[model samples]
Target: MEFVMETKNINKYFHKPKEFHVLKNISFGVKKGEFTSIMGKSGSGKSTLLYILSTMDTDYTGQLYLNNDLVTGKSQRELSRIRNKNIGFVFQFHYLLSEFSVLENVMLPAKKLGEKSPAEIERNAQQKLDMLHIGHLAHQRASRISGGEKQRVAIARALINDPTILMGDEPTGNLDSQNSENVFNIFKKLKEEQGLSLLVVTHDEDFAKRTDRIVQLEDGEIIAQ
Candidate 1:
Protein backbone atom coordinates (compact mmCIF):
# COMPACT_ATOMS: atom_id res chain seq x y z
CA MET A 1 0.00 0.00 0.00
CA GLU A 2 1.10 3.53 -0.67
CA PHE A 3 1.97 5.50 2.44
CA VAL A 4 2.10 9.21 2.95
CA MET A 5 4.02 8.88 6.21
CA GLU A 6 5.74 6.05 8.06
CA THR A 7 7.69 5.80 11.31
CA LYS A 8 9.79 2.85 12.33
CA ASN A 9 11.25 1.99 15.71
CA ILE A 10 11.03 5.56 16.91
CA ASN A 11 12.42 6.46 20.30
CA LYS A 12 12.97 9.74 22.10
CA TYR A 13 14.81 10.95 25.16
CA PHE A 14 14.79 13.97 27.45
CA HIS A 15 17.98 15.19 29.05
CA LYS A 16 19.07 18.12 31.24
CA PRO A 17 17.08 17.39 34.37
CA LYS A 18 17.60 13.69 33.87
CA GLU A 19 17.79 11.18 31.09
CA PHE A 20 14.20 10.12 30.61
CA HIS A 21 12.91 7.88 27.86
CA VAL A 22 9.86 9.72 26.67
CA LEU A 23 9.03 7.56 23.63
CA LYS A 24 9.74 3.89 23.17
CA ASN A 25 10.09 2.12 19.90
CA ILE A 26 6.93 3.50 18.34
CA SER A 27 5.95 2.59 14.80
CA PHE A 28 3.09 3.43 12.48
CA GLY A 29 2.16 4.40 8.95
CA VAL A 30 -0.43 6.71 7.42
CA LYS A 31 -1.87 5.84 4.05
CA LYS A 32 -2.31 8.39 1.35
CA GLY A 33 -5.40 10.57 1.80
CA GLU A 34 -5.98 9.09 5.24
CA PHE A 35 -7.31 10.98 8.24
CA THR A 36 -5.51 9.70 11.32
CA SER A 37 -5.48 10.81 14.95
CA ILE A 38 -3.04 10.20 17.74
CA MET A 39 -4.65 10.09 21.17
CA GLY A 40 -3.15 9.87 24.59
CA LYS A 41 -3.35 11.23 28.08
CA SER A 42 -0.89 13.80 29.45
CA GLY A 43 2.79 12.81 29.35
CA SER A 44 2.10 10.06 26.82
CA GLY A 45 4.51 11.67 24.32
CA LYS A 46 1.86 12.12 21.64
CA SER A 47 3.03 15.66 20.91
CA THR A 48 6.65 14.60 20.91
CA LEU A 49 5.94 11.96 18.32
CA LEU A 50 4.01 14.54 16.33
CA TYR A 51 6.94 16.97 16.35
CA ILE A 52 9.20 14.24 15.04
CA LEU A 53 6.69 13.31 12.39
CA SER A 54 6.31 16.97 11.41
CA THR A 55 10.13 17.34 11.12
CA MET A 56 10.11 19.93 13.91
CA ASP A 57 11.98 17.71 16.36
CA THR A 58 14.88 15.63 15.09
CA ASP A 59 16.39 14.66 18.40
CA TYR A 60 15.03 11.17 18.18
CA THR A 61 16.29 7.82 16.91
CA GLY A 62 14.17 6.45 14.10
CA GLN A 63 13.45 6.59 10.43
CA LEU A 64 10.75 8.86 9.06
CA TYR A 65 9.46 8.75 5.56
CA LEU A 66 7.10 11.26 3.96
CA ASN A 67 5.64 10.55 0.54
CA ASN A 68 8.09 7.63 0.32
CA ASP A 69 11.19 9.81 0.85
CA LEU A 70 13.35 9.02 3.83
CA VAL A 71 13.52 12.24 5.86
CA THR A 72 15.67 10.96 8.66
CA GLY A 73 18.81 12.96 9.53
CA LYS A 74 18.21 15.71 6.99
CA SER A 75 19.89 19.06 7.67
CA GLN A 76 17.81 21.86 9.15
CA ARG A 77 17.69 23.76 5.86
CA GLU A 78 16.62 20.70 3.86
CA LEU A 79 13.98 19.79 6.41
CA SER A 80 12.62 23.33 6.41
CA ARG A 81 12.25 23.25 2.63
CA ILE A 82 10.58 19.87 2.68
CA ARG A 83 8.22 20.99 5.42
CA ASN A 84 7.32 24.20 3.59
CA LYS A 85 6.49 22.41 0.39
CA ASN A 86 4.99 19.15 1.60
CA ILE A 87 3.45 19.72 5.02
CA GLY A 88 1.02 22.16 6.63
CA PHE A 89 0.71 22.76 10.36
CA VAL A 90 -2.10 24.01 12.59
CA PHE A 91 -1.70 24.46 16.31
CA GLN A 92 -4.05 24.71 19.27
CA PHE A 93 -3.86 28.49 19.00
CA HIS A 94 -4.80 30.03 15.67
CA TYR A 95 -1.52 32.01 15.71
CA LEU A 96 -2.77 34.40 13.04
CA LEU A 97 -0.92 37.71 12.81
CA SER A 98 -3.38 40.20 14.25
CA GLU A 99 -1.90 43.07 12.28
CA PHE A 100 -2.27 41.38 8.91
CA SER A 101 -5.39 41.08 6.81
CA VAL A 102 -6.84 37.59 6.66
CA LEU A 103 -5.87 37.29 3.01
CA GLU A 104 -2.34 38.46 3.67
CA ASN A 105 -1.99 35.99 6.51
CA VAL A 106 -2.93 33.15 4.17
CA MET A 107 -0.64 34.40 1.41
CA LEU A 108 2.46 34.67 3.63
CA PRO A 109 3.54 31.06 3.28
CA ALA A 110 3.15 31.08 -0.50
CA LYS A 111 5.19 34.25 -0.65
CA LYS A 112 7.94 32.62 1.38
CA LEU A 113 7.86 29.61 -0.92
CA GLY A 114 8.33 32.01 -3.84
CA GLU A 115 7.33 29.38 -6.38
CA LYS A 116 4.40 31.48 -7.58
CA SER A 117 4.00 35.06 -8.73
CA PRO A 118 2.37 37.60 -6.42
CA ALA A 119 -0.87 37.47 -8.37
CA GLU A 120 -0.88 33.69 -8.33
CA ILE A 121 -0.25 33.67 -4.62
CA GLU A 122 -3.06 36.13 -4.01
CA ARG A 123 -5.47 34.11 -6.10
CA ASN A 124 -4.47 30.87 -4.39
CA ALA A 125 -4.84 32.32 -0.90
CA GLN A 126 -8.23 33.73 -1.76
CA GLN A 127 -9.23 30.37 -3.20
CA LYS A 128 -8.29 28.61 0.02
CA LEU A 129 -10.35 31.10 2.01
CA ASP A 130 -13.23 30.53 -0.34
CA MET A 131 -12.92 26.78 0.06
CA LEU A 132 -13.19 27.31 3.80
CA HIS A 133 -16.26 29.50 3.21
CA ILE A 134 -14.53 32.61 4.52
CA GLY A 135 -13.70 34.43 1.30
CA HIS A 136 -15.94 37.35 2.34
CA LEU A 137 -13.63 38.03 5.27
CA ALA A 138 -10.50 38.24 3.16
CA HIS A 139 -10.02 42.00 3.62
CA GLN A 140 -10.74 41.96 7.35
CA ARG A 141 -7.87 42.00 9.80
CA ALA A 142 -7.23 38.62 11.31
CA SER A 143 -7.72 40.06 14.78
CA ARG A 144 -11.15 41.33 13.86
CA ILE A 145 -12.50 37.85 13.04
CA SER A 146 -14.33 35.60 15.43
CA GLY A 147 -12.65 32.53 16.98
CA GLY A 148 -14.09 30.16 14.36
CA GLU A 149 -13.22 32.51 11.54
CA LYS A 150 -9.69 32.87 12.84
CA GLN A 151 -9.31 29.11 12.96
CA ARG A 152 -10.58 28.84 9.41
CA VAL A 153 -8.13 31.55 8.38
CA ALA A 154 -5.34 29.67 10.03
CA ILE A 155 -6.37 26.57 8.09
CA ALA A 156 -6.43 28.61 4.89
CA ARG A 157 -2.91 29.80 5.68
CA ALA A 158 -1.78 26.26 6.12
CA LEU A 159 -3.23 25.32 2.74
CA ILE A 160 -1.66 28.30 0.98
CA ASN A 161 1.27 26.19 -0.18
CA ASP A 162 -0.90 23.24 -1.22
CA PRO A 163 0.84 20.84 1.09
CA THR A 164 0.48 17.10 0.69
CA ILE A 165 -0.09 16.51 4.38
CA LEU A 166 -1.81 18.74 6.92
CA MET A 167 -0.88 18.17 10.55
CA GLY A 168 -2.69 19.58 13.55
CA ASP A 169 -1.98 19.68 17.24
CA GLU A 170 -5.19 20.04 19.21
CA PRO A 171 -6.70 21.94 16.29
CA THR A 172 -10.15 22.25 17.86
CA GLY A 173 -9.07 22.83 21.44
CA ASN A 174 -9.91 26.54 21.44
CA LEU A 175 -13.35 26.31 19.85
CA ASP A 176 -16.81 25.63 21.24
CA SER A 177 -18.64 22.39 20.42
CA GLN A 178 -20.36 23.88 17.40
CA ASN A 179 -17.12 25.24 16.01
CA SER A 180 -15.30 22.02 16.75
CA GLU A 181 -17.95 20.10 14.83
CA ASN A 182 -17.57 22.51 11.97
CA VAL A 183 -13.83 21.97 11.91
CA PHE A 184 -14.33 18.21 11.97
CA ASN A 185 -16.71 18.38 9.04
CA ILE A 186 -14.21 20.49 7.15
CA PHE A 187 -11.53 17.88 7.75
CA LYS A 188 -13.86 15.14 6.58
CA LYS A 189 -14.62 17.05 3.43
CA LEU A 190 -10.95 17.70 2.78
CA LYS A 191 -10.09 14.04 3.10
CA GLU A 192 -12.97 12.78 1.03
CA GLU A 193 -13.10 15.40 -1.67
CA GLN A 194 -9.65 16.96 -1.83
CA GLY A 195 -7.72 13.73 -1.10
CA LEU A 196 -5.71 15.47 1.62
CA SER A 197 -3.90 13.44 4.23
CA LEU A 198 -4.37 14.64 7.83
CA LEU A 199 -2.70 13.70 11.07
CA VAL A 200 -4.27 15.32 14.10
CA VAL A 201 -3.29 15.00 17.73
CA THR A 202 -6.42 15.44 19.80
CA HIS A 203 -7.67 14.58 23.28
CA ASP A 204 -11.33 14.77 22.29
CA GLU A 205 -12.79 11.28 22.19
CA ASP A 206 -15.56 12.17 19.79
CA PHE A 207 -13.07 13.62 17.36
CA ALA A 208 -10.76 10.67 17.70
CA LYS A 209 -13.52 8.17 17.04
CA ARG A 210 -14.49 9.84 13.80
CA THR A 211 -11.05 9.61 12.23
CA ASP A 212 -10.13 6.85 9.78
CA ARG A 213 -7.83 5.37 12.36
CA ILE A 214 -6.70 6.13 15.90
CA VAL A 215 -3.26 5.39 17.32
CA GLN A 216 -3.31 5.36 21.08
CA LEU A 217 -0.23 6.17 23.11
CA GLU A 218 0.47 5.48 26.73
CA ASP A 219 3.55 6.28 28.79
CA GLY A 220 5.52 7.10 25.66
CA GLU A 221 4.55 3.86 23.93
CA ILE A 222 2.00 3.14 21.26
CA ILE A 223 -0.45 0.78 22.84
CA ALA A 224 -2.94 0.38 20.04
CA GLN A 225 -3.66 1.34 16.47
Candidate 2:
Protein backbone atom coordinates (compact mmCIF):
# COMPACT_ATOMS: atom_id res chain seq x y z
CA MET A 1 0.00 0.00 0.00
CA GLU A 2 3.02 2.27 -0.13
CA PHE A 3 2.69 5.02 -2.69
CA VAL A 4 5.70 6.14 -4.66
CA MET A 5 3.91 9.27 -5.90
CA GLU A 6 0.81 11.09 -4.75
CA THR A 7 -1.11 14.27 -5.46
CA LYS A 8 -3.61 15.83 -3.07
CA ASN A 9 -6.23 18.39 -4.08
CA ILE A 10 -4.32 19.31 -7.21
CA ASN A 11 -5.70 22.17 -9.30
CA LYS A 12 -4.21 23.85 -12.34
CA TYR A 13 -5.18 26.81 -14.49
CA PHE A 14 -4.07 28.13 -17.86
CA HIS A 15 -3.91 31.89 -18.40
CA LYS A 16 -3.43 32.61 -22.07
CA PRO A 17 -6.05 34.56 -23.95
CA LYS A 18 -8.22 34.12 -20.89
CA GLU A 19 -7.94 32.22 -17.64
CA PHE A 20 -9.30 28.68 -17.85
CA HIS A 21 -9.37 25.97 -15.24
CA VAL A 22 -7.52 22.91 -16.50
CA LEU A 23 -7.09 20.30 -13.74
CA LYS A 24 -9.71 20.18 -11.02
CA ASN A 25 -8.81 19.02 -7.58
CA ILE A 26 -7.13 15.80 -8.65
CA SER A 27 -6.18 13.51 -5.79
CA PHE A 28 -4.35 10.49 -7.04
CA GLY A 29 -1.56 8.10 -6.10
CA VAL A 30 0.71 5.60 -7.80
CA LYS A 31 1.83 2.73 -5.59
CA LYS A 32 5.34 1.44 -5.50
CA GLY A 33 5.96 -1.04 -8.33
CA GLU A 34 2.55 -0.21 -9.80
CA PHE A 35 2.09 0.18 -13.53
CA THR A 36 -0.64 2.78 -14.09
CA SER A 37 -1.95 4.46 -17.19
CA ILE A 38 -3.77 7.76 -17.58
CA MET A 39 -6.16 7.80 -20.50
CA GLY A 40 -8.61 10.31 -21.86
CA LYS A 41 -9.61 12.31 -24.86
CA SER A 42 -7.48 15.21 -26.05
CA GLY A 43 -7.53 18.20 -23.65
CA SER A 44 -8.71 16.04 -20.75
CA GLY A 45 -5.63 17.35 -18.91
CA LYS A 46 -4.01 13.94 -18.84
CA SER A 47 -0.73 15.36 -20.09
CA THR A 48 -1.09 18.30 -17.75
CA LEU A 49 -1.49 15.95 -14.81
CA LEU A 50 1.60 13.99 -15.86
CA TYR A 51 3.63 17.20 -16.00
CA ILE A 52 2.66 18.06 -12.45
CA LEU A 53 3.39 14.56 -11.16
CA SER A 54 6.75 14.56 -12.94
CA THR A 55 7.68 17.79 -11.08
CA MET A 56 8.25 19.66 -14.36
CA ASP A 57 5.25 21.92 -13.83
CA THR A 58 5.08 23.88 -10.58
CA ASP A 59 2.42 26.38 -11.48
CA TYR A 60 -0.31 24.25 -9.95
CA THR A 61 -1.91 24.24 -6.51
CA GLY A 62 -1.44 20.88 -4.80
CA GLN A 63 0.58 18.81 -2.42
CA LEU A 64 2.85 16.48 -4.38
CA TYR A 65 4.77 13.70 -2.77
CA LEU A 66 7.51 11.42 -4.07
CA ASN A 67 8.97 8.49 -2.18
CA ASN A 68 6.92 9.64 0.81
CA ASP A 69 8.73 13.01 0.73
CA LEU A 70 6.82 16.23 0.36
CA VAL A 71 8.15 17.84 -2.83
CA THR A 72 5.64 20.60 -3.27
CA GLY A 73 6.98 24.17 -2.92
CA LYS A 74 10.57 22.98 -3.24
CA SER A 75 13.00 25.24 -5.10
CA GLN A 76 13.51 24.60 -8.79
CA ARG A 77 17.10 23.52 -8.24
CA GLU A 78 16.02 20.98 -5.68
CA LEU A 79 13.17 19.82 -7.88
CA SER A 80 15.55 19.32 -10.77
CA ARG A 81 17.83 17.21 -8.63
CA ILE A 82 14.91 15.15 -7.37
CA ARG A 83 13.60 14.60 -10.89
CA ASN A 84 16.98 13.52 -12.25
CA LYS A 85 17.36 11.05 -9.45
CA ASN A 86 13.80 9.74 -9.11
CA ILE A 87 11.87 10.22 -12.35
CA GLY A 88 12.56 8.79 -15.79
CA PHE A 89 10.76 10.30 -18.81
CA VAL A 90 9.92 8.83 -22.18
CA PHE A 91 8.06 11.05 -24.58
CA GLN A 92 6.35 10.28 -27.88
CA PHE A 93 9.47 11.33 -29.70
CA HIS A 94 12.70 9.54 -28.99
CA TYR A 95 14.55 12.89 -28.71
CA LEU A 96 17.95 11.22 -28.98
CA LEU A 97 20.87 13.38 -30.05
CA SER A 98 21.18 12.55 -33.74
CA GLU A 99 24.92 13.10 -33.87
CA PHE A 100 25.72 11.18 -30.70
CA SER A 101 26.29 7.47 -30.59
CA VAL A 102 23.58 5.33 -29.02
CA LEU A 103 25.80 4.67 -26.04
CA GLU A 104 26.54 8.36 -25.61
CA ASN A 105 22.89 9.21 -25.74
CA VAL A 106 22.17 6.67 -23.03
CA MET A 107 25.06 7.97 -20.94
CA LEU A 108 24.08 11.64 -21.12
CA PRO A 109 21.75 11.76 -18.11
CA ALA A 110 24.17 10.00 -15.75
CA LYS A 111 26.91 12.31 -16.98
CA LYS A 112 24.76 15.31 -16.10
CA LEU A 113 24.05 13.92 -12.63
CA GLY A 114 27.84 13.55 -12.10
CA GLU A 115 27.31 11.02 -9.32
CA LYS A 116 29.43 8.32 -10.94
CA SER A 117 32.85 8.19 -12.58
CA PRO A 118 32.86 8.31 -16.37
CA ALA A 119 34.11 4.73 -16.57
CA GLU A 120 31.37 3.46 -14.30
CA ILE A 121 28.72 5.45 -16.15
CA GLU A 122 29.86 4.04 -19.46
CA ARG A 123 29.71 0.51 -18.10
CA ASN A 124 26.24 1.10 -16.70
CA ALA A 125 25.04 2.63 -19.95
CA GLN A 126 26.29 -0.38 -21.87
CA GLN A 127 24.52 -2.68 -19.45
CA LYS A 128 21.25 -0.81 -19.92
CA LEU A 129 21.60 -1.07 -23.69
CA ASP A 130 22.37 -4.74 -23.37
CA MET A 131 19.36 -5.27 -21.16
CA LEU A 132 17.22 -3.73 -23.87
CA HIS A 133 18.96 -5.91 -26.46
CA ILE A 134 20.46 -2.91 -28.21
CA GLY A 135 24.07 -3.21 -27.05
CA HIS A 136 25.08 -4.20 -30.56
CA LEU A 137 24.16 -0.70 -31.67
CA ALA A 138 26.21 0.99 -28.97
CA HIS A 139 28.70 2.53 -31.36
CA GLN A 140 26.18 3.47 -34.06
CA ARG A 141 25.10 7.05 -34.52
CA ALA A 142 21.63 7.60 -33.07
CA SER A 143 20.46 8.92 -36.42
CA ARG A 144 21.28 5.60 -38.06
CA ILE A 145 18.87 3.57 -35.97
CA SER A 146 15.37 2.65 -37.09
CA GLY A 147 12.35 4.21 -35.43
CA GLY A 148 11.70 1.24 -33.14
CA GLU A 149 15.36 0.99 -32.23
CA LYS A 150 15.44 4.69 -31.48
CA GLN A 151 12.55 4.32 -29.04
CA ARG A 152 14.34 1.45 -27.32
CA VAL A 153 17.41 3.63 -27.03
CA ALA A 154 15.30 6.31 -25.46
CA ILE A 155 14.03 3.80 -22.86
CA ALA A 156 17.60 2.79 -22.09
CA ARG A 157 18.50 6.45 -21.57
CA ALA A 158 15.56 6.96 -19.23
CA LEU A 159 16.71 4.00 -17.16
CA ILE A 160 20.32 5.09 -16.86
CA ASN A 161 19.73 7.03 -13.66
CA ASP A 162 17.85 4.19 -11.91
CA PRO A 163 14.79 6.33 -11.44
CA THR A 164 12.20 5.49 -8.83
CA ILE A 165 9.41 5.81 -11.41
CA LEU A 166 9.32 5.74 -15.19
CA MET A 167 6.79 8.05 -16.84
CA GLY A 168 5.83 7.95 -20.47
CA ASP A 169 3.80 10.38 -22.56
CA GLU A 170 2.30 8.38 -25.39
CA PRO A 171 5.48 6.35 -25.64
CA THR A 172 4.16 4.02 -28.33
CA GLY A 173 2.04 6.53 -30.21
CA ASN A 174 4.50 6.76 -33.06
CA LEU A 175 5.21 3.06 -33.41
CA ASP A 176 3.62 0.37 -35.51
CA SER A 177 1.67 -2.38 -33.81
CA GLN A 178 4.58 -4.77 -33.59
CA ASN A 179 6.92 -2.20 -32.16
CA SER A 180 4.25 -0.97 -29.83
CA GLU A 181 3.84 -4.47 -28.46
CA ASN A 182 7.61 -4.72 -28.11
CA VAL A 183 7.68 -1.57 -25.99
CA PHE A 184 4.84 -2.87 -23.84
CA ASN A 185 6.67 -6.13 -23.31
CA ILE A 186 9.72 -4.22 -22.25
CA PHE A 187 7.68 -2.20 -19.77
CA LYS A 188 6.11 -5.38 -18.39
CA LYS A 189 9.52 -6.93 -17.99
CA LEU A 190 10.83 -3.85 -16.21
CA LYS A 191 7.93 -3.90 -13.76
CA GLU A 192 7.98 -7.66 -13.18
CA GLU A 193 11.73 -8.08 -12.88
CA GLN A 194 12.96 -4.72 -11.62
CA GLY A 195 9.84 -3.56 -9.75
CA LEU A 196 9.94 -0.13 -11.38
CA SER A 197 6.91 2.05 -10.82
CA LEU A 198 5.44 3.47 -14.03
CA LEU A 199 2.85 6.11 -14.92
CA VAL A 200 2.05 6.66 -18.55
CA VAL A 201 -0.41 8.95 -20.39
CA THR A 202 -1.66 7.21 -23.46
CA HIS A 203 -4.56 7.29 -25.91
CA ASP A 204 -4.18 3.66 -26.89
CA GLU A 205 -7.01 1.63 -25.38
CA ASP A 206 -5.16 -1.62 -25.73
CA PHE A 207 -2.11 -0.21 -24.06
CA ALA A 208 -4.10 1.30 -21.21
CA LYS A 209 -6.11 -1.85 -20.67
CA ARG A 210 -2.98 -3.96 -20.41
CA THR A 211 -1.61 -1.93 -17.53
CA ASP A 212 -2.22 -2.80 -13.91
CA ARG A 213 -4.65 0.08 -13.50
CA ILE A 214 -6.11 2.84 -15.61
CA VAL A 215 -7.07 6.32 -14.48
CA GLN A 216 -9.54 7.80 -16.89
CA LEU A 217 -9.77 11.56 -17.22
CA GLU A 218 -12.49 13.69 -18.72
CA ASP A 219 -12.85 17.48 -18.94
CA GLY A 220 -9.88 18.04 -16.66
CA GLU A 221 -11.04 15.64 -13.97
CA ILE A 222 -10.56 11.98 -13.23
CA ILE A 223 -13.82 10.23 -14.01
CA ALA A 224 -12.69 6.72 -13.30
CA GLN A 225 -9.72 4.86 -11.90
| CA RMSD of each candidate after superposition | 0.6, 0.6
Summarize candidate 2's per-residue lDDT along 1-225 as a digit string, tens digits.
799999999999999989999999999899988999999999999999999999999999989999999999999999999999999999999999999999999999999999999999999999999999999999999999999999999999999999999999999999999999999999999999999999999999999999999999999999998
Instruction: Score candidate 1 by lDDT.
Output: 0.94
Give a tens-digit lDDT track for model 1, residues 1-225: 999999999999999699999999988999989999999999999899999999999999989999999999999999999999999998999999999999999999889888999999999999999999999999999999999999999999998898999999999999999999999999999999989999999999999999999999999999999
Give candidate 2's TM-score: 0.99
User: Which window of ten consecutive residues has the lowest lDDT sum in model 2?
Assistant: 25-34
Location of the lowest summed lDDT over 10 successive residues in candidate 1 = 154-163
Instruction: Please provide TM-scores, in order, for all candidate models, with all chains considered together.
Output: 0.99, 0.99
